[model samples]
Each structure stands twice: as C-alpha cells, then as structure tokens.
Target: MATAIGMVELTSIARGIETCDYMVKAAQVDLLRSSTVCPGKYMIIVGGETGDVRAAMAEGIKRGGELVVDTLMLPNVHEQLIPAISMTNQVDVRGAVGVLEFYSIASAIIAADVAAKAANITLIEVRTGYAIGGKGFVTLTGDVGAVRAAVEAARKDAELLVETTVIPRPDKKLFDALL
Candidate 1:
C-alpha cells in the first residue's frame, strides 16, 4: 500500500496547526500533524493519501498567504509507507521515540504533557536538561507512532511559547537504556 506524505513549512507554529486541522477536516483523511519550530521558522509534516495530500498542501499555502505569512515556504509532497504497527495495536514499544528541546523547564513540561495526551500514553517521563547553557529537553516514550506524534505536538506547543528545538529519535539506544 502507498501512503502520501505531505510536508509544509509554515510561517508560524500556531498557523501550522490550524492549517493541519483544516486540511484534515477538508480532506476527511485520518492524518497526523507534527511540527518543529526553529529560530524564525516552522516546519510542519502532514501525511496521508496522494490526492488529498496534495490538496492539503495547497490549503496550507492558501492559509499562510491569507495570514500574511512573512515567509511562505513551498510545500513538499511525497508518497511513502512503511510496514509498522498501527496506533490501534497494543504493543509495548521501547526506544527513543522523540525529544523536544526547550529553553525552560516550564515549557518542556507543558510540551511533554500535551504530547503525552495526544499520544494517549499514561506514564510519560519528561527529563529536563541543560546541555551547556539553560536549554531544556523533554523526552516522551510509549508506542512508536504515538511517541512520534507526541514529540511533534510538543514542538508545536512550544514553538511560540518558548525557544525550542524538536528532535525525533532515529536511533533507539538512549531511549532503550532508560527503559
């Protein structure tokens, strides 16, 4: 089976979430919205089927323009799928799913809690850290897909609220060790 992946770089984190909600409802597709906001930029990823995927990307552009986005980024649309467990499957997954780095502990906790709720995980352990300066990191665990979603949600939640960086775990060692 082929799945369409649509990635839209938006002007603001809030607008990105709004655009995603609009696209999801308009296309009537079961989709997930994840965002990462760096300094002066926001990148949002919305994935689903090809046809609707394209349309959703278009909607994002439209919304961004209407919102007077200072920088309207070109939407990147693609199609890809992997043989992974669905969110419905109750599998005890263990690994470093995703980590959202924040500038403050308050922001980190806020993002972590939001991600946990979105992912439907009860026991979410949020680790706070200051690598060198006063940067904080929030790590969420649980089902693979859920953890990914949670991380994205956390990023979106923290974008404007604080200065942060969201990092998804491509390697599972660190997360596995913690477990």
Candidate 2:
C-alpha cells in the first residue's frame, strides 16, 4: 500500500506529460493520475513509499520548472484518501454533511486528507477537473460536531478561494444530488 501521495499541477499539458514520465522513471511511484484539467491545465498525481514519492515529486518539479503552478506532498496520508480520490469510497450517507471547496485541485486534495485525519468522518467524494472547471471540492459525513470540525480544519489548510458549509441534517434529495 502507498503510504504517501504527491501531486503537481502544471500550466502546459505537454510539459506535464513529460514531467509525469520523468517522475515515474525517477522512482518506484505509482502514477495515480496524469490528465488535463479545466481551463487547459494539466496535473500529475503519484503515490508510493514516502521516500519514493519525494524522489518522484522532485523529478517532476525539476522537469516541469516554470510550467509547474501548484504542488502538494502528503508523506503520511490517511487511509481513506486514495480511495476517495479514485472515486471509489463507499458513502453510507449518514450523519451531518460537510462540503469544502477550493480554487485548485491540489488544495482540495490536501484539505480532504487533513479533514479525514482531523475527525471521525467518512470522505464521501472528492470532485476535481473538467466537470468542475478546474475547481475542486470535498464532501464528508459524520456527526454534527465532527463534520463541523472537519470542515474547519480542511478550510484552513486549503488555499485560494475556499468555501465551507456544514448541513446539520441534509435532505435525502440533497445527498442524492451530491452522489
């Protein structure tokens, strides 16, 4: 299992692909994502051992250079984070719900990890890329206090225009739409 995750956002799609190649070749890291984002941006995500992830990120950054726009490296990631990012996490849809939105995918991912580690919450979803126009958001569910705390912690860790809301007990339709 990968114990660490790293992502690098780039302005040039061609350069992003090149960086992705260099990153994976530099270390034994899994390429989790390498695709274009909204507004003509590109992103690369990698996961592996902490040291391997660091080495891959270093190579990506070196190759990306000025094309690199944003980056994040979580050496000790929460267990639920990867599944949530992969859009495979099971959402029980119980308890209060919290939503955290950010201007960039990197920020959204970072916040999601922090939120999961902060409280006893289940990550419902982490939406990013084209459907959202490059902006990203995370949804989680837990008890009222846990949801609130998770939202706040995530909001603080994110950058750019961050917005957060906690629904005491969301309507079924609301959650249905969320899913």
Candidate 3:
C-alpha cells in the first residue's frame, strides 16, 4: 500500500485540535504531530495508507470550516519527507545547497517533498512554523545542477514561495547551524 501524508492548518488552535480528534476517529490514520505554531496557528499532520489519509483529511477540512488556512494530501510522499520534517534525518551536506522559504508551514513541507523528489539531493532540514512567526523553510544539498533543478521544481506552481536560493559552495559554518 502506498503511504500518504495529510496536513491541516487552522487559524484557531482549539478548533484545530477538535478537527484532529474527529479526523482520527473517522479513519485509520496516525496522528504524527498536532500543536500550535508560531503566531498562534494550529497544524495537524497525519500519515497512513493513501485512502485513510484522504478520509481523515476530508473530515478535518469539513470540521475546520472557516478556520482552515490550508490543507494538503500527498498520496505518495517522498520517503525522506517524514523523517526530515520530524528532524530525525541526519544529512551529510555536500556540494551546492538550496533553500526555499514559504509563508506557511504546510507549504514549506509540500515544497520540500517536491524538491527532494525532483533531483538527487539530500534534505538538510525542514523547519516549520515554530519560532519563525508562522513562516517555514527547507534546506537541501547536492551538486549545483541537481540543487538548481530541485529548487526550480519546488518553485513551480508554488504560490507561497517567499524566496529560493542556491549557494554553490556554502560556508562550512552554515552547515553546522542547519544540519
């Protein structure tokens, strides 16, 4: 079965929590993370089989009402995405580096997945709306060509892309902070 990931971002923390509760009860999805983010937004991330994830997201969106800020359902998420989002992946930064910034946590996550799958790159980190005042960023490293390709792919159709940059030879100290 193809694993999937679903996310719901809401303006109200209480409503987001309630929606998450209802969503979990409506499907066989596992709640990955549910908490308030910077600037007082709420986000819920869930994972499971594609059908289950879709069902859960449908319930969340229905209950979210006007509180919904964004919703995402990736039926075949990149294998590196979940680990990177959870900050559990250890990446050896090499070659060029790419960075993508977004206004929302959900958008950054989606862009990271797209970039990781677009080229041969290592996801350095996926920082969501924690201390960045509801903004998020993703970092990746690979050869210059690969990194550029990945960044380009991430930029396509991404309305939330605040900034995108590719550093051919990033400072070693930079990796110390990011990875």
Candidate 4:
C-alpha cells in the first residue's frame, strides 16, 4: 500500500505522473501510489529511495510553513491570533486569532482566512476591532479544534516569514462579546 515504488526510473513514470491520464488509471490500481495533489503549490512529489521519501516529507512540511508566510504578509503589522470558542449547545469554535498587518483590514482578513482554512475551520466572519496597544485586530471564527489547529499550522506555515503567538480563549465576558 505504499504510495511510491522504490527506486523508480526517472522516465515516463515521472513524466506520466506530471501529465498523463494513465496516472489516474494507475491510481485506480492502487490508491496509495504516491502522488502530488498540488504540485509546486502546497504539495510536491519527490521520489527516490525510501530514505529520500522520508526527507522529502519533512521538507514538505517545512516548505508548507514557508508558503503560509509568503501568502500571508506578517511583517509591518501587529498580529495576534487565538481560538474563539462558543458556549452554545454545540460548544463549537467558529473563528481564529485576529491577524494584523500594517493595520490594513484587508491584509489582516486575508491572514485570518488563510489561517482558518489551514486549521480546517469554516471562516464564519471576520471582525475588526482595537487591540490593547491601539493596534487593529481582525478576529475570525470557526470550529474550536480547527481554529486551534489552524493557528498552529499558520504559525508553522509562516515559520520563515513571521513570528506568531497563540492566545487561548479568554474570559467568558470577552468570548460572549465576540460571539
């Protein structure tokens, strides 16, 4: 069930994976066949010996972090991200920590959106408000765990581009106010 065959020759097989209907047919033969979902974007398939695959996976995760920052502008903005939890019967979380950049609402919103999806949450809404330092904040909401994970993923994704901090849900009053 391995996705990749060991020591594949760099010929038609690699090229076929890049552009060929047979790639899909081959997948039908085995769903585990190593394939890149979004080549050159968030995903890439680099094949070699078993050891190479291991290193590639690690590098992929690392590169993903780099992509997150490139896509989300972190510098020149006061950014603070946290999970927003709901106290309703669903007990669901529906937003992410506000991502601020250059005090530009649009950029902050984009960061929040990218962070939200990376964390696997539905972006319910994006709201802007004042931070403690008079800096602007863009708050996003979605599933609780997704929001938490997204924040983490966003940080990892932007590891090279920016530094980030995680803020857990605050007091009941504040949570209620945001909801």
Query: Per-residue alpha-carbon lDDT of model 4 for 1-179, expressed as tens digits?
Result: 22221111112224424422322223222112222222221112232233434444443334343332122212221112222211122226534443323232223344554575565554323332223221123344455566667656544533222334333555566656655
**Off by more than 4 A, model 1:** 66-179
Predicted candidate 1 versus true structure: per-residue lDDT over 17-98, tens digit per residue: 7776776766644554344444434444445566766777677777766542332112222111110101222226554456
lDDT of each: 0.48, 0.88, 0.88, 0.34
TM-score of each: 0.38, 0.90, 0.90, 0.32
- Worst 10-residue stretch by lDDT in candidate 4? 78-87
Clash statistics: count for each candidate: 0, 0, 0, 14
> Candidate 3 at 92: error in angstroms?
3.6
- Cand. 4 TM to true fold: 0.32
List the candidates ranked by lDDT, beginning with the highest: 3, 2, 1, 4
Provide C-alpha RMSD values for all models, in order.
12.0, 1.9, 1.7, 14.5
